[model samples]
Target: MLTNRNILLCVGGGIASYKAAALASKLVQAGANVQVAMTKNAQQFVGKTTFAALTRKPVYDDVFIEHDASKIAHIDLADEADLIVVAPATANLIAKLANGIADDFITTTILAATCPVVVAPAMNVNMLEHPATVRNMERLMADGVQLIAPGVGNLACGWIGKGRLPEPEELVETLSGLFQAKKLENRHVLISAGPTIERIDPVRYLTNDSSGKMGIALAEAARDAGALVTLVHGPIRGTLPSGITTIDVESGDEMLEMMLTHYDQQDLVIMAAAVADYRPTVTYDRKQKKIDGPLRIELEETTDILRTLGERKTTQVLVGFAAETENLEHHAQQKLIRKQADFIVANDVSRADIGFSSDENQVTVYGKDETVTPYAQQSKTTLAQNLIKQFAEALR
Candidate 1:
């Protein structure tokens, strides 16, 4: 898939630098012209000779190399590449790129490049969570750089957290996805995600166990397809996918308002949020004191956002989700018909491993023609990709 692509691989100073050598070989095997640039400190972990052997090219590491005015290798190398990849991007290098510090050849070429840049960060858990590093990462994202998130596992620093670099094959797959012409280019997608909170008192609320993993996966998949995606998210702790515009909200009412404001602008709308069906009529401003007796509360129905949007939708594709414990297909079909949604994704939430907070899900999609497609248990990310692919085909 990456045939004839020019890839400049930047290896930074980290314990994960050894992975870069394997990554270079993988890229080369995939028919990419690979060039390696290494930081001086990186040599301690992985030798420059290994990279040279893998890529069959001279490893660039100096700013004052063979010092001739016409032989400015950094600029030349930067201009010749189609994509720049930084594996094991240490906190120092990320800060340097974010702050435009070009004291080294790698940073200098990064500054000089005009193509897309992808970074895989690897460091101590504490360093990854540091405020400065987080800020720098956000800055890089705003600048259109793509980050392949670090895997969570045992780190060299004796910490167990998310600081491990993704495997070499995964990095190569990410690069391939980035360079492939996006299938959903110029499409506008609006997605609602997470479980909405319904307040009963200042400290008490009604919510679900939804972790937003499915919705987040869908957002990431849509973004990868080159769609202009706006994610209306409820209270969830998952990371927002790179390149998506996120609007965070706490309650179902707020989510509804955001969706109403943006839905008209989209060609597709997916209502994946698990909104509260009922809420306390009177929400106390302060925490209510619990008595040693049963408490009685007046409940009212919340706004049906999908129904409202379905009523207003004209040519836009509208999709809804149903999490049911009984009569799943019957209820989902009724929801699809009643809400006027084009399709309903229904799943049995009673299965502890298949729904709500789980990383994997199994769902059945009901279409207007009563056609049901069953999706077996799989990672939410993979399921999202499948859903988007089907949606894109329907759009076409």
Candidate 2:
């Protein structure tokens, strides 16, 4: 997939800089035009000559040194790159990138690059865990930067923790995976996201605290996989993603309508929305005034959209999401059978850190064949990419 691709490898100042050189070689061997950019401190660890020899391209290290007088070197590199990867990203480099401080050659070029930016952070464990670093990294992720999370092992600083750069081979695999040929090319995907609002009255409604980040992330991931994605969403907390068909609905019934409307044309259907399971049995058309006593609302079950879709699925890969507070895998497995879904993605919503309204999530996927895959806590975006790829493969 990396054949004939232009990859910008930005090296940072860290012991892991050596690994970056190896990574450049691997990318070149995979048929990518690898261009290397190094920070001043990175030159100390791995000389520019080493990278030049491996990539057979000039290694850029200075912002002022322009080989061509006509075009700005940084801008030219940024414009030509298909992807930008900052491996062995030191704490200082990360901060600089996060804050848009372009003092160095690498930082300046990265700032100018509009392509996807992937960062692999390598630093001391303490520096990795510092509040400022954490905040900066979060900002970068929020700004749509892909993060290759550091591994946990013995560090160059002699501290044992999660600040080690992954091996060259692993880095190459991960980076190559990012540019994989679109598995869902020309396929149609239907995704539902956000919280369904069940109205009790004109001014009152019942809804969960779902922010729709996961669903939106899934839509983006599916789109990136080259699918014609149609996103059926509810009231989302953030801006909706572009380059897809997005239909806004307020209640489960509306979402159901949108999903079923696009169901027959979809190759894959993912029910990621936090749909309200129940709605008021008696809904008031007008806002009711405060009663002297506590008012009660009788509720009825909403249509099970996932089960409906699963029943109708013929050539489609059907996936369901189960948000459980207890007995997660059991509930997911049960849902898989009951809903007749090919896979059930279950997550513990009880965790304060990684579910519902949060940027990160951890999910266990339960397949119909009793295959259970537990994914650790990670950004919803990354998880969505993995899930979309798996679903697309299953569809094929």
Candidate 3:
């Protein structure tokens, strides 16, 4: 699938640098045009000759060296690259790239490259835990760089922890996904997001902490995969992406009505919104003033949109989400069965660092067949991309 794609592999100085050689070989054997570049310190562990012999191209390490004599090597390499990958990315290399300190050929070429860049961090556990390294990784990710996060295991330094480069086999799959085919082409996707507000009075309402980022991310991903998306969202503080249909709603009933109206036309339905379970039995025309020491408000169950859709659905894949504080997988499995959903995206809202308002999430996807897929903490955008890809596969 990666045939004819020009991939530049940048190897930083680390014990994990050896694994990069295998990655380059894998890409080359998979029909990718791989070019190897190494740092000065990287050459200490893996000789420049070794990479040249493997890639059948000169290994680049210096910005001063001119490979073509006319074109600057760094610029030429950067211009030809369709994608650049940094395997065994040491803390220094990460910091340098994040701070724009391009003093070496590897860094300089990366600075000149306009293509997508993916980083696989490899360092000591302590170094990875350092605040500086953490900030650098976050900054890189924020700058639109993809991260193939490190794996957890025994390290060469005798301390077992994260910071180990993911095996070359896994890296290959992640890179392939960068250019995966758009399996969702021509498909219509319907998505619901954010927390639905059930009005009590003009001044107050009942809602959850959902910020709607997950649903929005999925909508964008679906659009990117060539699917037409309609986003039914609640009142939330975020901008909508262009090229997709967007509907605003306040209550669960409103969202349900809109969804059902458009349901038959969709190929996939993702119920991601944190819809209110109950709404006030009675709503006053005006804000109620504090007249008594205690006020009683009766509640009524709102519409069960997922269950309703499951019953009404035909020739469409139904997906639901479960946001729980405990027994996530158990709850997700039950929901998957109860709602007759094909899959349920379940997450523990208990983690303060992720879910709801956070930019990242960790979730386990439960399928009706009892199959489960777990995804670790990552940006919602990344997670959505993966989910959309998998969803497309499920359709096949």
Candidate 4:
């Protein structure tokens, strides 16, 4: 997907600098032409030679050096880049970027670049939470910089908390998605994801294990494909992509309502959310305190969102997700027919590594003509792009 794409990798001064080397290599393996730029402090962690060996291009760290005037190296690099990525973006670097301080080569190129900029921050938990750093991050976001938040884990500073950089594989997947062809350009896509919460009381509610990662990924993928995407998301812990419009909902009925209102505007509809099959028949406005006797609650079925969309679908392609643990194919095929969906993506939630809150998934796509396409286990982001590719081809 990254074929012929140019990625300017700006390495910042931080202990996570070594991860940048792996990031560069991963980008190359994924068919991107990578150019490495580093801060002077970054060299203390990873050598310039390593970046050169991996990218097969001279590492740029000095701004005083002169290149051809007509083809100024920094400006030329910025002009030609499809995307600029800053991995291990230290506090200082993030601040400089947020404030437009171009005292160095990395910041200079960033200031001169016209492409999308993505920054993955890595620092100690204290630094990450510092008011100055937080303010700077907010400024960058306001200025249209995409941030991949640091993961939470053990840090090099011996403190166990947030500020760990995302793994190289995940970063590679994100970058690849950013530069993919805009197959869904000029199209509108509506996607629903995550589990809806039905409030039993102010203090209690019913929901599921759905993390909404897959649905969010689809929204992002569709947006990257140049589609105007709207994600109707239930209560989810994961962050939404930067540019897509999001509508938050709390119950299956609410989701259905939102979908019905916006469904007519979409060229494609994807029902990936794990809406509650059953909701409390009666929801109490106030908290229900602990009762001495056993408590019982009546359950009622929620609206059939997918079936409704399938019935209303005309030229728009409707996709549904079926997560089954047993008789996966049979169940999925039945749902595909019953829901009148154009395609149904089925996965086994029995596996611990994929599906339902997991980072990876392997799915089988069942088309209306009984055709099945299987995909290997991959990150939700990658899976989303693959699905969008298939959808785009079907449209063509």
What TM-score goes with each of the models?
Answer: 0.77, 0.74, 0.68, 0.79
Which candidate model has the greater lDDT, 1 or 2? 2
What's the lDDT for residue 176 in model 3? 82
RMSD of each: 4.5, 5.3, 5.8, 4.3
Provide the overall lDDT of each model, using Cα atoms, as 2-decimal numbers: 0.87, 0.88, 0.88, 0.88
What pairs collide in candidate 1? none
Cα lDDT of candidate 4 equals 0.88
lDDT of each residue in 1-396, candidate 3, tens digit only: 689899999999999999998898899988899999899899888898888878898888888878888899999999999999999899999999998888999889988989989998999989997989988887886676766657666999999766778888778877886787788889999999999999999999999999998998898789868899999999887357667899999999999999999999999999999999999999998999897678889999999999999999898999999999988877888898889999999999888767598767889999887789999876676778889988898887
lDDT of 4 by residue, 1-396 (tens): 787799999999999999899999989998889999999999999999999999999899988765555667788899999999999999999999999999999999999988999999999989998989988887887677877757666999999877888889878877776766788998999999999988898878888889898898788778879999999999987346678889999999899999999998788899999998888899999888899989999999888999998988888889999989999999999999999999999999888778596657899999998899999876676688889989888777
Q: Which stretches of candidate 1 lie above 4 Å from their native place?
A: 66-69, 157-159, 201-224, 235-248, 285-296, 304-315, 319-390
Candidate 1: 10-residue stretch with minimal lDDT: 376-385
Looking at model 4, residue 42 earns an lDDT score of: 97
lDDT of 3 at 93: 98
The whole-model C-alpha lDDT of candidate 2 against the native structure comes to: 0.88
Q: What value does the lDDT take at residue 94 in candidate 2?
A: 93
Candidate 2 wrong stretches, greater than 4 Å? 1-5, 10-62, 68-72, 86-174
Q: Candidate 4 clashing pairs? A: none
lDDT of 2 at 193: 93
Give the lDDT of residue 338 in candidate 3: 88
Which ten-residue region of model 2 has the weakest summed lDDT?
236-245
